[model samples]
Target: MMSEWLVYPALGVIAGIFAGLLGVGGGVVIVPILLFVFTTQGFPAHHMMQMALATSLGSIVFTSIASFMTHHRHGAVRWDIVMGISPGILIGSFSGTWLAAQLSTRALKIFFACFLYYVASTMLRNFKPKPSRQLPGPLGMNGVGVVIGVISSLVGIGGGSLSVPFMMLCNVPVHHAIGTSAAIGFPIAVAGTLGYVVNGLSIADLPTPHLGYLYIPALFGIALFSFFSAPFGAKLSHKTPVVTLKRIFAVFLMIIATRILWGAL
Candidate 1:
């Protein structure tokens, strides 16, 4: 328990470092870390994944704020995209949490592992879809948001993996895509957090210092550092040479995903 104080903040630092730079790392890092810690600490096997997902989202609520605000200052965020997609994001994120709460832990782990693998491969290849058209109409944006929001809730991600690609496909620039994805993460986290909290309220014997699926101690630890560090990452995104670093991160995600898949299966 005491050691958790030291290590949980480390998770925050990692999350904050990547949140703005990649627009997606908060959940990618935090969910698996929390899942492992909770499993070792004798948290309910059946509920641990949901707890991890919820807590990660809660942390992202803060991290994404710092990240997107920084990106906005750099003139990288796409406000039109954020506004057009938010309605659907809210609906899909909330509903997806209900679906996640109903899923078995094994099912969730398998899905999340696969998603990680996909993200890794995409990052490794530096894949960006060729622009086919301009930004979509409101209805189209809403529909796209639904898919991204649903997947983000289920996988406990910031939706950058999905949204960034989609944005690039629609001719949005890379920095803008990443920044808009950060902005998009906020609503997804908010709706997903609420859904997980509401869904988990009736469950018994959860760990203390919890709000529904959120483990407050971990949330506090993560948020504290992530808030301060996220701006740094956002700044770096505007200036850093990240090709080599991105490859390294991609390989890291690959390793983590493979390990998770092994455990899940």
Candidate 2:
């Protein structure tokens, strides 16, 4: 038990550092780690995926804040984009949370496995830098935002994978796209966390130390350490080689996805 408690905080530090450095939603790491930890701790098999997703979303709340603040200070955030996406994200997140709650553990595991594979494949592709172009109009942006929110919330991710690609497709600079995606993660985290909390109210036999689906101990530990480490990640992002990092991340995601899929089957 003591060792498990120690591990949770250690997981937080590692997740935070990666989130900061890579701009990943942290789900890429947190969800798999939580699945391993919760399963090892004798959490009910059916509840493991739910707990993992909830814990991951909960951790992102703090990590996103730190990341957003860092990117904001660097003038990478596009306020207009955030505003355009906020409403759709709020609505979509709630819907996605409800959907996740209705899913059986087996289904959720398969879903996550597929999602991870998709993300990994995309990340493995080489991306060329592009110039920013004006989006068609409010309607188009809002349409994309809704999709991003729904998918991101359901997957327990920060929408960076989707949002960055969308921005890049729209001709936004890669740096600006990344920064804006980080900022957007804040609203997605807030909305998604609230949705999970509300949805978890109806679930019975949740593990101890839980509020809704969230494990308070895990949440507290992740938030505490990630808050400090995310800024460091932001600094590293500027200096790190992005293509190499993406390749490394892609390999990591592939391994995790295979493991999760195999475990589920």
TM-score for all models, in order of appearance: 0.94, 0.92
Q: Which candidate tops lDDT? A: 1
> Per-residue CA lDDT of candidate 2, range 1-265, in tens?
5776688888888887887787677787888888888888888887677778877778787777777776789898888888887788777877787888888888888889899898788778855436456654777777787888788777888889888878887777777888898888887878888888888887788888788888888888777787787777768989989778988898989999998899888
- Candidate 1: minimum summed lDDT over ten consecutive residues — where? 17-26
Candidate 1 to truth, TM: 0.94
lDDT of 2: 0.80
lDDT of 1 by residue, 1-265 (tens): 7877887898888788886576556788889889888888899998999999999999888877877887899999999899999999999999999999899999999999999999888888888899999888999989988988899999987788889889998999988998898899999999999999999999888998898988898998998888887778867977877776778888998899999899889
As for model 1, its CA RMSD to the true structure in angstroms is: 1.7
- For candidate 2, list the clashing residue pairs, or say none: none
